[model samples]
Structures are given as C-alpha cells and as structure tokens.
Target: MKITKLTNNISLKRQLEGGNEEQLKTVRNVLQDVRENGDEALRKYSEMWDGIKLDDFRVSQEEIEEAVANFDEQLKQDLEEAAANIRYYHEAQKRDGYKLPLANGSWLAQRIIPLDAVGLYVPGGSAAYPSSVLMNVIPAQVAGVERIVITSPAGKDGKLPAAVLVAASILGVNEIYKVGGAQAIAALAYGTETIAPVDKITGPGNIYVALAKREVFGEVAIDMIAGPSEIAVLADDSAYADEVAADLLSQAEHDALACAVLITTSEKLANEVAEEVEKQLRELPREAIARKSIENFGHIYIAESMEQAIEAVNSLAPEHLEVVTENAESDAEKIRHAGAIFVGRYSSEPVGDYFAGTNHVLPTNSTARFASGLNVDDFIKRSNVVYYSEQTWQESAPKIARLARMEGLEGHARAVESRGWTKGDK
Candidate 1:
C-alpha cells in the first residue's frame, strides 16, 4: 500500500462520480433491447454472457426443493444460522402503524404499509453468493412484503446454484427467475409475460445493473445507485499491522475498483501494515484482483493526531469503517458518518458480511454521508392520514383562507368561503 499525505479542499465529486460512460451506454442498449423483446431477449443474453441455454426462465418450486435436499448439509446449516441472525436483527426494524389525536376534534397518523412486491437481483457470474440472498430477502419478509422475486443467471450447466435456491427458499421467496444482468433489472422494473413487475427492486450487480437502475428510476423504485465496495480503517499505535492488512485485503477482494484506505496517527504502524499487506498478498486466491485494487485505490494517510484521522474518515464517508485504537469503542463513538462501524480487532469485515448480525448491504462511493444500508424500512412505505370534524374545520377556516389569499390562491379562499361563511369587513 502506498502512503499519501492528505490535502485540504479536495474535490470529492471527482472521487465519487461513477466511471466509464461507454459501459453505461452498453447497459442502456441492453435495457432497451430487453424492454422490447422480453423473455426472448433474456435467453439470448444468458447464452451470450453466461454460456447457458435455458428452456425455462423461471425456477419451479419442485426444483428449489430438490436443490435444498441435494445441497451440502454443513453449508445448509451455516446458511440457516446466518439467516436466523439476519432475521433476528431485521425483525426489530419492522415498524407498526401509529395514530395521534389532535386536541381539536381531529386525528393525525401515519400508516406503515409494505410494498406489494419486490425484486432481488443476485450476481452469478464470478461466484455464488447465498449470503446476498439472505441479506436482501429477509428484510422484505420482515417488512411484510407480499410478493418477492429473485433473479440470477444459470451456470453453464443451466442450473441455479444449490446454495442460492436453498437460501431463497429458507427466506420464503418463491418467485425465482433465471435472468441476469441488465435484462434481469428490466424484467423486474417492467413486467413481461412471465415475470411480474415489482414496486421496487433491491440488490447489487455489475455496472450495467447500476446504470439500468438509474434509467428505470421513475418507473420503479431502486435501493441505491451502489458502486464498488469500500472500507476505511482508523488505526492508532495500538493497532496490529497484520490484522489491519488482512482487513484491507478483505475489501480489496471484492473487485479491482474497490477501495481499502487506512487513516492512522502512527506512521510506524502504517509502514508495518504496508509490509504486512505485501507479505499476505501472496496467499490470497483472488490476489490479482486484490493487488489491482490495492495498487490503484488503497492508500495509507498519516495523521498528526486521532482527531485528524477521524476528520479524514468523515471526509471519505466509507461504506465500512473499522476503528482499532487504544480505546476502539471511544474512537467508534466519535465517528459521525459511516454505513457500519466495526470496533476492535475482533470485529472484521467478514463478520459483518456473514455472521455479525448486521446488514452488510451498505451505501458505497461516499454515499454514507447521506444514505444508509438496506433495512426493513426500505421495503415499506408510510402514508400520512388526517381526519378533521366540521367544528375543527370551521374554527380553522378563516386562518386557512387568509393564508391562501396571502399566497395569491383565490380559488383556495373561495373554496373555504363557499363552506358557508358570511362576508366579513376587513
């Protein structure tokens, strides 16, 4: 990892804005073709990209059951454990409807209603991520969404991963489609003969999927315009260099574009961590991707003090933040912006990703400053309600009329006047 000094007045817009307009245009073309051609377009893309020729685009319940039975028992147990932890965390996020009564013969309240349907897109090209299935679907289930649909591509054998199917079934998401990439996003955003349109879509995919979500925003709701995964570690002299190096590499393994930055008050620890990263990089299965990510985006910034390190962290607004200092919890408390904060050496990235009982689907590309991770609230809507009796309306009419007239809304004033008010002298 390269050590770089921090500068003032840096343009974050240059850092956060997405890359490769040509790739975005390619995604746009795929979305348009799918919108016009429907299932046939999905089949062609699946064959072209994944090398799988599918007779049916949707997975049947029987297939799911067989998958669940045939899957490795130990992996199945691990998934169930992860699912239980996820459900336990998100179940607390489920909100109940509430009502408030006004002193004046009126009632005001909000109703929390779940979306009628939701779509979850899980990437399938590079690896099978059953953890994603649990992370995305369990929240919707806890939120009481009625219909949940899942989309993923088939392998060259034209079979969905057993772990993916088992995870979906465990989460009670029965609707599974084999379409992937931008076409899957289109299928979820706009319904076809086979796939039903959903009110909202959630999940992470390639740049094409991100661009497609940006294009279909008004037509259907999307979770967020997520970019590559990023993690920032705030370390001090007490931090272990090898552990810091491993955590950085964990995020770097995501993709070549992922960022793993360290903001440290101790230059000695920073130099040691760089050496540790070089030592550990030789053993990783995805060393090529991790090395590229570390080479391009990873950096160590030496800070004069802990406060300056924190200032650097807030400016970055990283998706995942790990604080390892003399007092890690105290350092974590000082943080104001981060999608998720993991404190101490024991709290690593994969713990949150797999079994730490927190949502791992977090905001990326500095969006932690404004946005948040996936939660039960993302699957539900709250509608405001107001009820007023005739007496309350009569009491407030003059004020309403005056405000409306002051704003040059004569029609609104007349509407109040027509409610049986006598003409008044001003």
Candidate 2:
C-alpha cells in the first residue's frame, strides 16, 4: 500500500460519479424493455448474460425444503444465531410515534406505518453470501414488512445456492425468485405475471444491478446504489500492525475494486502494516483479487497529528471506520462520518459484519456523509397528523388568513373561513 497526502479533487469527482451517460442510457433501456416485454425480455437477458434458460423464475417450496434439508446442523444453527442477534438489535430501532394535545385543543401526532412489501437482491456468480441474506432480510422482518421476497441468479442446473435458499427459509422469505441482474430489479420494480412488485428494494449487487436500481428509483423505492465495499482504519503507534493489516484485507477480499485504507500518525506503523499485508496476502484464497485491490486503491496515509488523521478520515468517509489510537473512544466520537465505527483492537470489522448485533449493509464510496446504513426505520414511514378544534381555529384565524392571502392561496384561507371563525375572534 502506498501513502499519499490528500491533494486531488478531479480524481475524487471521477470516482464519486460512478456510471457515465452511456451506462445510464443502457440501464434505462434495459429497464424499459423489461417493463414493456415482461418475461420474454427476462428470458432473453438471462440467456445472453447468465448463459441459462429457465422454465419458471420463482423458486418453489419443494426447492426451498430441499435446500434447508441439505444444510448441516451446525450451519443451520449458525444462521439461526445470526438471525436472532440481528432481529434483537433492529427491534430496538422500532419506533411508535406519539400524539399530543395542545392547550387550544388541537391534536398533533405521527404514525409509524410499515411498508406493504420489500424485495432483497442477493448476488450469485463467483460466490454466494448467506451472511448478506441475514443482514438485509432480518431488518425488514423486524420493521413488520408484510411481504418479503428474495432474488438471485440460478446456476446452469437452474437451482439457487443451497446456503442462499437456506437463509431465505430461515428468515421466513418464501417468495424466492431465480431471476437476477437488471431483470430481477425490473420484476421487483414493476410487477410481472409471476412476480409481484414490491414497495421497496434493498441489498447489494454487481454493476448491472446497481445501475438497475438507479434507473428505477421513482417507479419503486430502492436503497442506495452501493459501490464496492470499503474499510478505513485510523490507527497510531499504539495499535498492532498485524491487526490493522488483517482488517484491511477483510474488505479487499470483496472485489478487485474494493478499497482498504490506513491513516495514522506513525510512519513506523504504516510501514509495518504494509509488510504485514504482503505476508498475510499469500495465505488468502482470494489473494489475486485482494492483491490487485490493495495495489490499485489501497493506501496508508501518514498524518502529522491525530487531528490531521481525523481530517483525513472525514475526507474519505469510508463505509467502515476502525479507530485504534491511544484514546480510541475519544477519536471515534470526533468522527463525523462513516457507515459504521469500530473502536479498540478487539472491535474488528467482521464482528459487526457477522455478530455484535449491528446492520452490516452500509453505505459505501463516501456516501456515509449523506446516507446511512440500512435499519428497521428504512422499512417504515412516518405520517404527520393534525387536527384543530373550532376554538383553536378561532384563536389562530387572523394569522392563518393573513399568511394564506399573502401567499395568494384563497382556497387555503377559505378552508379555514368555512369553519365560521372571524379574524377578530379572541
């Protein structure tokens, strides 16, 4: 990993913008074709890209039962444990809006309503991520979403991964579909003959799936179009070099484009981490991808002071931030941006990813500054409610009338006027 001072703006814009005009146009065309041609277009794209033909896109109960039976008892127990932890954490996030009565007898309240349906997209190609299934599905279930669906690509044998199916079964997501890519997104966005459209979509995917979510934003609500996973560790001389190296490699294994950064005040620590990364890289199964990611996008910045380290971390706003300094808790509190923060040596990134009862589907590519990680709140909506008694209307009549007329909205003034309240009433 190379260390460079932060001094580039144009390059930052290029990375943040993600897709160009051409890619947007292509994605838009695919979404349109799916909307118009329906299942016919889905079959065509599945053959062209996935190199498979399917008789039915939705996974059946028999398939799910078989997949669940195939899993060993230990694997099944692990999935259940992860799901239980996720559920407990997210259930605490459930909010019930309250109603209040004013002195003038007016009522104001907010009602929390769960969405009707939600869809989750699980990537299938190189490897399957049952862990991702637990992360995305459990939150929606805790939010009390009515209908939940899972979509992933099928293999040449026309079967979804056993682990993916098992996870879906464990989460009570019966509506599993074999379709993937832009087609699965289209099916979720706009209802097909077989698959019912959902109110919102969540989960991660490759470039095409990301582009599809971007294209169908208004037609159906979507979680952010996620970039490659990222992790930024803010450490100092007090931190162990090998521990820092291991956490960075955890994210690099995601893909060739994934980013892992180390920002610290110790030049010595930086050098040690770089050497430790190389030593650990040899033992990883995804060594080639991790090597390329670390080579191209990874870095170790040497800040002159702890304040400068915090400033550097803010500039990056990485998806995951690990603070391991002399005062790690204090440093973590000073951080303004990051999807998730891990403090101290024991709080590794995987702890939150698998256990520790926190959502792992977080914002990436510097989106932490504006967006947030997926939670139970994402599946619920808040509606503001208001009611004014005749006495309350009378008290505020003059001000309401004046403001409504000032805005040239006579209907707004008359709506209150119809209540038979005079401007002079007191």
Candidate 3:
C-alpha cells in the first residue's frame, strides 16, 4: 500500500467489467440452446467446459447422506450452529400483508409473497465456499421459498466440492446439480428434464456466469451483478497497524481486482499501516493475488482531520468498512455508505462473512452507494392490493376519471366511469 494525501479531485469509483462481444454471443447461444434442448444442451456444455461427461445432472440423496456422514464432527456442529444463527436472524425479517386505513371502508394493502423457487450458484473450482452455501440457502429458506436449488460445475472427477455438499446437506437443501457456467444459469432460469425453473437466482460466479445472469434477468429475477471484494478502514492512532493491515489483506486476497484502503487523520498511523501491510503481505498464503490487488487498488490516504477522513469514506462507499477510531460506534453513525460496518477492533470483517448473522453477499466495487446485501427481501415479492367501498368509489370516480383524461388515457377514464353511480337493478 502507498500513502497518498487525500485530494479533492480523486474518485474512488471503479467500473464493473462488462463481458466482451464473444462472451456475450456465447452466453446468448448457451441460453437459447438450453432453453430449446434442455438437458441435452446442459450435458454438451458441461462436457466441454467442465471436462466431465454428465450422466446425471442432479446429485442423489445417497451422495448427500454420504457427504453429511463423512463430514468432520466439529465442523458439522459449527455449520449447524451457523445455520441456526442465519435462520434465526433472517426469520425476524419475515413480513406479513398489511392494509393502510382509509375512510368509508376503502383501503390498500401491501402483500409480501415469497417466491416459489430459487437457485443459488456457488462458485467451484480450485477453492470451495461452504460459506456461500450457508449464506444463500438460509435466507431463502427463512423467506419460506418452497423449492431451492443448488448448482455448481463438477470437478474433473465429476463431483462438486465435498464441503459445499456438506453445507447444503446441513441446511437440508434437496436439489443439487453438477453443472456450472452459463448453462447452469439457463437451467435454473428455464427448466431442464431434471431441474425445474426458479423464480429468482442468487449467488456469484465468474464473468460468464455474471453475463448469463444479466441475460436472464427479465425472465427470472437476479440479486445483483456483484463486483470484486472491497474493504475500507477508517482508523486513527488508537488502532493497531498490524490489526488494520490484516483486515485490509483479508479482502485483498479475495481477487486480483480486490480493493483495500485506509483513510486516517494521523500521518504516523498511515505510514505505519503502509509498512505493516507490506510486511504482512510477505507472509500471506495468497501473496501473489493480494500483492497484485494491493499494488493496483490499495492506498493509505492522510486526511487533515477526522471529518475529512469520514468524508472520504462516504465518497468511496466501500463494500466492507471497518471503524477503528477512538469511538468506533460514534464514528459509524456519521457514515452513510457501506455494505456492512465493523465497529471497534474486535468486530472484524470476517465475523460477518461466516459466523455472524449478517449475509456476506454484499455489493462490491462502489455499488454500496445504492445497492444492499442479500437478505430475505431478495427472495420475496410485494403486491399492491386495493379495495374501495361503493360510496368511496362513487365519490372518487369522477375525480379519478378527470385525472386520467388529463393524461389522455381515455380507456382508463372510461373504465372507472363505467362502474355507475348507484347499484340498482330495474
């Protein structure tokens, strides 16, 4: 990390990588083929991309049981406990339809309806993310979604990650598939012989998966187009340089494009943290990736005052923010933009990523300026309900018709006016 004086003209926004023309064409073809050919297209693509022949796309109950049976006892207990925490937290977010009172027995209500089905796409390759499984499945389950599906590309050995399988089993997720890439997205959006279509899709994947999600968005709802992981620390001299460096590196190791930043009022703390980051980076497991990320996106900005530092943080609107000042909670109140805020030294960013009740699927890049983390609200829909008593309608109909006519919507005006002033049969 390099130290930079916080300048008035600098911008922290990073653009999302859009798919190339060839990738877009490939995604379109794959989606269309899957929509038309169903399971056959899925098999062909799986064999080509994942380097494995697909016999059965769905994971069997026997395999689920075996994964659960062979999982580590301590890890099993941890996952169950994590699942309980996630379920308990999300359960409180549940909502019911409620009506707004209106005079003359006329009212409107907002209906909260859960999607019938949802698909969670957990990335698989060299690494495994059982945390993704737990994070995605628990909220949809709490939202009361009836059918939840899991899809990930199989390894060359023709199996998804065992840890992922174990986590899904812990959550009692019934449907698991050995497919990935755009084809898995298509299968989830449009249905195959074995897999059924879902109303929404959640979770992240590679560029191809992201493009596929963007392509199928109107057909089936998608959470958001996630970007690289990011963490911004607002610290002062009270913070430990080593602790701050470790927290910055936590997100930096996620991807070569990940971003880690520090904004502080103390020049001494900024320089100390910069040196500490380099020292810690030398010993990290993913040093290559973290170094590249820190080299490109990491920075330490010295602000003239804490107010200026807080201003820089809100301008950045980072995905994960750590407040390690004299009064962490008090400073956090002044912040307006962040996917998740970690208060105090003990409240590390990883706490929310895995064990904490909060969801880890956060908006990355600078999208935290407007986007939010995944939650129960993502798995449900809201409908507007309207009712009008005869008297209310009669009193309001002419005004409604006159307003519709002002907009030149003759059909709307006529529709309301056709309801007649009185209910009487001669």
lDDT of 2 by residue, 1-426 (tens): 887654423122115347778877877888888888888888888888888998788899999999998788898998899889989999899888999989777899999999999999999996888988999888898888989989999887888999999988888888888899888999899978888899999999878789999878898899888888899999999999999999999999988888999998998999999999999999999999999889978888887789888877887888999999989999999999899999999999999998788999998888898989999989999999999887887788878988999999999988877766334565
What lDDT does candidate 3 reach at residue 342? 94
- The candidate that wins on lDDT is 3
Give residue 328's lDDT in candidate 2 (0 to 100).
97
lDDT of candidates 1 onward, in order: 0.88, 0.88, 0.91
Candidates, ranked, TM-score: 3, 1, 2
**In model 2, which runs have C-alpha deviations exceeding 4 angstroms?**
4-17, 421-426
Per-model TM-score versus the true fold? 0.94, 0.94, 0.97
In the order shown, what is each candidate's alpha-carbon RMSD? Answer: 3.0, 2.9, 1.4
State the lDDT at 25 in candidate 2: 81
Colliding residue pairs in candidate 2: none
Q: Give the per-residue lDDT digits (tens) of candidate 1, residues 1-426.
A: 989665555422215447488988888888888888888888889889988888789999899999998989998889899999999999888879899987676998999999999999998875899999999998999999989999998888787888899999887777899988889999998887789899999999987888888899999999998888899999999999999999999999999988999999898999999999999999999999999999988899888888878877888889999999988998889898899999998999899999867999999888899999999999999999989777788888899999999999999998976765564655
Task: Identify the candidate with maximal TM-score.
Answer: 3
In candidate 3, what are the lDDT values of residues 345-410, reduced to their tens digit?
A: 999999999887889999887788899999999998999999999889989999999999999999
Judged by lDDT against the true structure, how good is candidate 1?
A: 0.88
